[model samples]
Structure formats: structure tokens, C-alpha cells
Target: MDLAEMIKILDRQLTTEGRTIHVDKAKEHMRIEQRTSGQGVSLSLSELLRRYHEDGEEALNQTILAIDRGLHAMASAPHLKGKESKIFPVIRSASFPDHTSDGRRLITSAHTAETKIFYALDLGDACRLIDDQFLDQEGLDEQSLIELASFNLSALPIKIKKDVVKNNTFYFIHTNDGFDASRILNRKLVSDMQAKAHGDLTVAIPHQDVLIFGDVVNPEGYDILAQMTMKFYTSGTIRITMLPFIIEKGKLEPIFIMANKRPMPGKSKR
Candidate 1:
């Protein structure tokens, strides 16, 4: 197949294998099939074409074949290139039986075989790409890198996050673990959420994550939430994602101010 077609195939396999980036190539390109660059598991277009130019069509065939093997490895193995490892979902559907109504169950994380050395990784760490050299090159420490990941792309918590925001206090939720970033019940917080938190707890953010414990029994308390959310977003500190929601008595109750759509024009009066 042509170089573009070959890339399309590899990318498709990456998607089917549930990888954000199956092949690493330069992001900006001047032309199709032009070789920009490649990193680790990702293949660059020029790199692929070089192979084709050297060996003709057989080069394309061999590369595609290699990609097929990678897809298989991705399914059965935790992709590793030196010290760093890809991250996956931490919890599975079997973890919770009651919330069978498409909550965390909707998340799909890879299953990887683990062999410990200096460090260990699990299928749950899929959302993150942790590399010693990469982090060093970026001029960031592991802790801060992990914290940055936790705040946005990942659900994995590198350490106990920022101070817990109590009722009437302004706080934020963040995680490095990406799969369950929205999930309020973390391994560390499960027992507490189950035994301690009663009604009137809300998780606000740019994303539908990071719980804020507030007293709903207080009049205009929820209004305070809306104001806080708007200020946090508009203050240019964070990017607001989903409309804010609350865990009132252990259930998801969407706030009216966050609603984006109205009822149809033709409907019976309530």
C-alpha cells in the first residue's frame, strides 16, 4: 500500500488497540508521507518512506507487519521502552456491581503483564506516559510532572493531592489517573467517602472531577458553588470542562444553571 495508506492502517490499529498514540511522528508536516521524525514506538512518515525507498514495496510490507505485532503486544503486554511505561485504567467493571448503570464501567483500560524491576506499573496507569529521560528533558521533576498529569490527563494520584476543601471552602480536584479522573471514590478515599461523607458533597472543576465538600442544607449554598466554579474558570487558572454536578445523598444531581438545552417547543405543561 502507499505510505499514507500504510500510516492510516497503523493509526487505525493504535485506535483499535486503545492507544492515544501508537506511533510517534512529527506533529507538523510539510507534505504527505514526508519524513519528519519518530520517537520510540511511534513511526515517522519519512522513516517509513526511507524503508520503502531502500527496499521497495517490501519495506512497506515489513513495517506494516511489524505494526501488526505491536498491536498484539499492546493487547497482551504493557508497552515498555526502557524505563517508562504506558498507563491504563485502574479499576474495572467487576470492581463495582451496584453502579452497573454505565459509570466507571464505561471506562476501558488495557490489561498488561507486570514484571517489577526498579519500579512497578499496572494496567491502571495507562493514561500517563512516564519516562525518566523525557521528564528530565522537559526540565520537570517526576513529582511535578505527575501532578500536572493528575490535574488534567490522568486519574492516577502520584501523592495525596492538595488540601481537601470542606463545606463553604474553596478547593479543587485533580488526579494523574486519567481513566477514573471523574470518579470521586479513589482507593485512598473509598472508605472515607463510604463511611464519612453524608449528603451535601459536590465535586467542581474544569472537568467533572475533584470533589468539594459543601453543606447544601445552607440556603444559597449551591449558588455559592456556581459562583466559585465561574470564578475558578474565568480567573484563568483552569479550563472548565463539564457542567458542575453534585453528589446529593450519594447520587448524581445536575444543577440547573449548567443545563445547556431546553425542552422541545411542543410539550405538555408541567
Candidate 2:
């Protein structure tokens, strides 16, 4: 199927089934980074290029496809069981003290009690740490890092608030860099939320892709397209970067919305 149909299916699964592969990807990625100590076991940029160069695009693409499928399956798995094979009292009893059978039960109970903490530290912290490392390379600086860390610290509580939104609720993430835009724009699943784009700035899943709400801008001096908008849906911490040249030259800079009102019923999602 084409990307549009694939995205439509994903969207339907999210809205109607109360399930989404996207969330699964997030969870699977979380687990992988945790397992790898925050450095993903997946291929790096250099490795990906080398694979492509030596094996050809088909081989490289297949590798990526397999990874994507793994992520999807990991995300889609409905059940996960965590183990507690180490507790101090149990370990001590088994190795040295030879404590009573009741002591084993107590140790097991305690280990079970700490599941939330263990999961939080292992799953949440690992994911955020690894994601932050990547985002920093993508464009985040020190201040943005701090802000995102704060957001991750509160992610659990915040995710609850996020869950209350209606099924059709949309999200748009805009960044000042065109590279980031290019990286994500091809994913129709995300781009559907976009309402506009200018230059390096691109919108996701606009209700109308052809009837663009904003014009594209090719800004000079920087190798990028630049624009801004306000209609973006924001549920978590958002990092905004105004292009440096725009700031230095005291230019007004193009502004655009991140999100827009849903198209009228029967209107096509272009």
C-alpha cells in the first residue's frame, strides 16, 4: 500500500481501536535504548551509509525495513512481564544466611513493590536519556536539554493529561531547522497534522495539502526554509528556535500556526 493508505490505517487503528503502532514504536524504542544503555543497537548514520554503499539500496532498505518491523511488533505486543530475580534478603539467604522460607516470600514481596520505581528508572529514564542525546545532535542546546529533561521528569503525570484529549486531537511539532523537517516530513502519519509549511518549514497532515494555508519561503544566507506559526497543538514541552540570522538582522520572520481547526466534515484530508 502507499504511504497515504498506510497512514489512514494507522490513524483508524489509533482512533477507533484505541491502539496505535506509533505508541508501540515509542515503547519499543524505549526498551531498546534501555537495553543498550542509551546507545541504540540499531545502525548509526555511518553504518547505514556503509551498508547502502557496499550492499546496494535494496539491502540497506531491507535492513531498515526489518528494523521498522521489529519496532512495530515490539510496540504492538500487548503484554510484557518484568522479572525480579534479585532482592537483597533473598540473595543473602540463598548465598550466606540460609534464612527461612518466609524470608523468601518477604524478599519477593519487596521486589514486587519496587516495580514502579524500576520501570520508571529503566524504561523512562533510559528512553529520555537516549532521545535527548540524539535530539541534542539534531539541534537542541543546553537550555533545551534542561527543558526536555524537566518534561521527561514529569512525563508520566503529563501523559495522563494528554490522554484526555478527543480522538481527533492533532499535534504539530515545528522546529527552526530544515534538516529536522526533512527527516520527519515523509512520514505521512505525522505530516497529516501539519496545516502549513514555508520554505524549510513543512506542515504535517493538513486537511488540504493542495490548499496550503501558508506560502513556502526560501530564506537567504541560511541553507534553509524559515517560517513560524501558532496553531500547533502542544501537550508537552516544546522547543522553539528562531533562526539566528532573523534575530541578528531584526527581521520580522515568517509566522504560521502549528495546528488548525479540523476541516469541515466531508472535506478531504489532503
TM-score of 2: 0.17
Candidate 1 per-residue lDDT, tens place, 1-270, comes to 565675675565444423444334455121212112221244557656665665677656655554444334334434334323332322222222212122222222221111001111333422222345434554556455444433432344433343323334333444433333334434344334434434444555432223344434333445666666565433221133333555434543445442322211111111
Find the 10 residues in a row with the least total lDDT in model 2.
85-94
TM-score of each prediction: 0.34, 0.17
Task: Please provide, for model 2 over 1-270, each residue's C-alpha lDDT reduced to its tens digit, 9 standing for 90 to 100.
Answer: 333433343344333222223323332221122221222223333343444455565644454444444344333322112311110111011121222212321111111111101111123211111222233344534344333333433321111011111222212323321112122212332243233322222222111101112212322202111222222211101112221111111111233222342211112222
Please list the residue runs of candidate 2 whose C-alpha ends up more than 4 Å from where it truly belongs after superposition.
1-41, 78-270
C-alpha displacement of 207 in model 1, angstroms?
3.4
Q: Residue 39 CA error for candidate 2 (Å)? A: 12
lDDT (0 to 1) per candidate: 0.39, 0.25
